[model samples]
Target: MSFTQKFYTADHHFGHALMLSETACARPFASTKEMDECLIDCWNSVVRKDDLVFHLGDFSMGLGDAARVESVFRRLNGRKRLVLGNHDYAKANVIHPTLAGLAWDAPPAAAMETIDEGERVYLSHYAARTWPGQHKGSFHFFGHSHGRLAPFGRSRDVGVDCPDTGYAPRTFKQLVSGMDLEPIVAEEAESFAP
Candidate 1:
């Protein structure tokens, strides 16, 4: 099947050493270095320089220096866009400034809407139980849960930590093709049953 140029992912937590600890995010990496390297490799492997990437939120953690964070962001492929996460603030400035310096586009809101393949897609850092156009076949994508929450209705977690996505950014085609929406649709229908 043909795919859209847009790819989605979030919660990279780059430079965050806790992500590699067994007691923290419980990532399988033995060290933060390994985790960062692997994530960068996985990202560049699928995303091209020309591709557009929608990173829902939490791109990095523990890297407080804007210059260092900017450096890391520059190394990643694709035209980047961000929906700021809670961890994104450092010192007195938002991370968007650094990203903007590198040509990354940061939408002002925590949530935004876009059209893809004739479908409305809601992008947010946190998942919502009921979103605009939820009953109109619109899709909602979010991060922040890190794969802990189950997807409902037409919503899906786009976090890199989401097991279903193999810790990499996924294209629109891949997400739709891989999703089995029957259960979710049936549940929604049941909710409306008298």
Candidate 2:
């Protein structure tokens, strides 16, 4: 399918009841059904049928079966590429068939590095302190933190729960504009380890 733009998002946690609890992401919605529909609407509101989306991870959970998961996946707009999360696994390290059958632009991966419009973008389901090209102007984005993890160096969480992402997919330009983008220097990283 043809695409006009690229967007990034993750951690929708559809059908996952724990996501509504205060100990979890504390989603304001009263129920998973409400959260799911709102997430789908938020995605479709900014994403178009021809837009490409890179979902970092945790797309769905507790949906019972593949058919149910597929039902939700079909409602969102865009051609999707997924970076597998801990929840996406079925067993023996295999992705669920329903996700595999979704006509993804490429095979779902645990991590990926791409050249986008002459810029390098690295993607994963979890954050990293330093990535390939951290000092060469490359950008690294990930999800899975649900906004709990703070931005570190050139990488940051792109999960929907993050305020910067605004509970929806975001473009590279929009994400980068809010980033410091300063090259990581040796001695710049600090650790509390004894």
Candidate 3:
């Protein structure tokens, strides 16, 4: 059986610690403390008590960093799920209470099964391309590009990253009917890398 429910996602970079400050490649964050503060603030601000959060990926710097962040996530009240990202690999890593479990380099299609049939919601750490044909009917919610996509219009689905950011979440009906997500797409990340 498939389940459908309201979902929210935050990339929760903990201030992007596992990354270099000025470059695109992966590296440790310069200010771990500051990043932790911002991450907590952002996550607390958006998540409600009953809200289901699908943590798209990149939850922490690595296995060593997991305990710190996991403690924070555990304290915050909500239903959670995780789709392991590239940055999550390491020892001493503890999984979140609601995590589906660790996923190394699996394709989103395999993960798609975790989502309910015909459920319009999605969440992820990075942007992904719209599936073609039958699979194209669902809406995809993801992060990773970090507030970089340019806004095209309201009707486009190609660019909208988060639901609360002004861009609307596309419904299953909209995608299948061939409605214009041009505005969504125009502002969306250039390509869905994974």
Estimated TM-score for each candidate = 0.84, 0.90, 0.53
**What does candidate 3 score in Cα RMSD to the true structure?**
8.6
Question: Tens digits of per-residue lDDT for model 3 on 100-194?
Answer: 23332242221232343334444445555543121334455445564454322221222123333432222234322443343234224345334
**Per-residue alpha-carbon lDDT of model 1 for 1-194, expressed as tens digits?**
33437889999988888777766579998786688888888999898878889988888765546677776788898878888777765544555455445567554456788887777888998998777877667888999988888877678888887876888899877777756544334466567667
lDDT of each: 0.78, 0.84, 0.44
CA RMSD (A), model 1: 3.8
Best by lDDT: 2
Better by lDDT, candidate 2 or 1: 2
Candidates ranked, most accurate by lDDT first: 2, 1, 3
